[model samples]
Target: MFCDLIRGAAEVSICYEDATAIAFLDIQPVNPGHVLVVPREHYEVLQDIPKAVGAHLYQVATKLIPLVQTASNATDMNIVVNSGAAAGQNVMHYHIHLIPRKEGDGFDVPLPFPGSVMPNRQQLDAMAARIGSMLRDPLQNDGMKLG
Candidate 1:
């Protein structure tokens, strides 16, 4: 769907464009002037995008933050990248949403979940160690199991 927008087949109110990426107003915005920055090349997932292209996407988004915020008269902004289907990503092609925020605008992101529990210190250590081990070496196991 986004590829169509990039190819000029579908209509888009483009705010920014370059060889690697394109930024346009979202068809259905969380707030007015919400912009979506996307890579020109089709990438199904965020990890599939090359490091340079991924970095470029963010760099462009950062540059656009002030523009969208000013246009929307927003007090703040939320730059969101819903990476996968499980993470509320409706679109398969990875894109970043630069949403302008205003005080009492009532546009809430569903970040808080009901009945979430805090982990103990040991659980936190074990989780961190697992992630750290994976970063250092994918195959190496810290052998710190948790329930």
Candidate 2:
């Protein structure tokens, strides 16, 4: 599917492209100027992508933000990625969504919870420490040289 897009055979409008990644206007957009940024190489999910490639995808996405905002005259934007099937990922390839937001755009953004819960300091600290301990050096594990 993506190979077709890259080759200009998919009939989708191309917005930006470089050697590492490509950004295109989403055919079914939430709002005008919505784009999807994808790496040139296949990566099924976030974890499957090399850290440097993933960073490049995001870097391209970030660079396009101002352009999308100006073109759409959007007040804000949402950078989204549905990583898995359960999380609404229909495309097998990894991509970052660039959804432009304007006032009364008719899209209701939902929160993870209806109300915020304040966790105790001890609980928060413990959770942070546990997560920090599990973070591996990508270079040591995968030999990824991220700039």
Candidate 2 residue pairs in backbone clash: none
What is the TM-score (0 to 1) of candidate 1? 0.90
Quantify all predictions' global Cα lDDT against the true fold: 0.89, 0.87
TM-score of each: 0.90, 0.82
Task: Name the top TM-score candidate.
Answer: 1
List of clashing residue pairs for candidate 1: none
Give the C-alpha miss distance for residue 44 in model 1, angstroms.
1.3
Clashes of each: 0, 0
Q: Per-residue error at 113 for model 2, in Å?
A: 2.5
Mind giving the per-residue lDDT tens digits that candidate 2 earns over 1-147?
Answer: 886787777687888889999899998899999999998888888989987899889889989999999999998999999999998999989999999999889986687655878799999999998755555566444544334
Q: State the lDDT of candidate 1 residue by residue for 10-112, as single tens digits.
A: 8899999999999999999988999999999999888788878999999999999998988889989999988899988998989999999988888877656
Cα TM-score of candidate 2: 0.82
Stretches of candidate 2 above 4 Å error?
115-123, 136-147
The global Cα lDDT (0 to 1) of model 1 is 0.89
